[model samples]
Target: MVRGKTQIKRIENSTSRQVTFSKRRKGLLKKAFELSVLCDAEVALIVFSPSGKLFEFSSSSATSTTERYRKCIKNLRPSKQMDDSQHFEEEVAILRKKIELLEETKRKFLGDGLDSSSIDELEQIEHQLEKSLRIIRSRKILLFCERINQLKEEGKILRKKNAELREKYEERQLELSIGQQFSSLEQVKEVETQLFIGLPNR
Candidate 1:
């Protein structure tokens, strides 16, 4: 049936809105079901009314539909770790450019020997190189210092554990020594008794 062309706006009447929502929801679900059954295609739809009521439909169970959605979306997504690695590569490229400039300055300093004009240029290049070298040295020192600190911390922890183990080992050794002493005393007493029994009258 050809109904009158309706203006696309919010229906002011609550009852009319509710009626339209119900009818449209049913029609949408019907179309989805028909598409899935006739075309053998997977279909999913979720709807929420302005009143905060939820209505959902899927060709599969709710859990299966969510799983399918995840699979579909993830296939189109880029990995985060790969993106971060690319950023790191870009930073490395900038550092490479700095190195290239430093090398060029060095070649100019050497190939074109230091005259008055060359000396001025040499001094400028030297200053820039010193700055770069200082930065590089500082970074290297920091890296090594951090590594040394980590090693020292590890050594401290190991020493504490070694002290604990040494105490335990000494305690075990003392116990074993006491046990051996008891065993020796018992042996001596047995020998004494045997000697006394075999002795002439005292």
Candidate 2:
């Protein structure tokens, strides 16, 4: 009896799987041979069993056929530029992942999380953090210096106002003292004149 049509997925039963493998392998080889013979064309087929047994078929000497295959592969190889572009894309992806990981580790080191990480990766992240810290410290120092300079300018203005007030106070004090002296002298003169004018004995 003919077997039912089988699906292309892996067969679960061990015996059935092996039997299917053998049947398909033979059928494929048979078709390849028929095609080669009908077309009068060179053909080569290689099959390997799941158990590591090798099988080979070639219309010509295996060596010559293999050489021809190698030549064809050489002629059809992808261009160097294409290979370089593909490699560049892979490297860029790797670098982007590294940057993302470093950023995540930076957050962890700054008390963000307790993610599992390697010591080496942590060290790299630490170095990156150190660099960022230095930059932040430098900026902070610059801002502080600017603030200090502004305060100094303000202090200079306050000092100038203080000196001006002191000078104005000194001038006011001198004017008050001179006016009191003149008034006291005038009073003394007036009393002497009155005493002389009213004196019985001089």
Task: Predict model 2's lDDT versus the native.
Answer: 0.86
Which digits, one per residue and each the tens of the lDDT, describe model 1 over residues 1-202? 8899988999999999999999999999999999989998888888999888888888877678889879876876477657878999999999999999778766765655345446677678788778989999999999999999999999999999999999999999999999999999989888743345565986
Q: How do the residues 15-83 of candidate 2 rate in per-residue lDDT, one tens digit apiece?
A: 988898899898988987887899988888888888888877777766788899899878774897589
The candidate scoring highest on TM-score is 2
- Global lDDT of each candidate: 0.86, 0.86
Q: How high is each candidate's TM-score? A: 0.38, 0.43
Q: For model 2, what is the alpha-carbon lDDT of residue 107? A: 81
Residue pairs with clashing backbones, model 1? none
Determine which window of 10 residues in candidate 1 has minimal summed lDDT.
Answer: 109-118
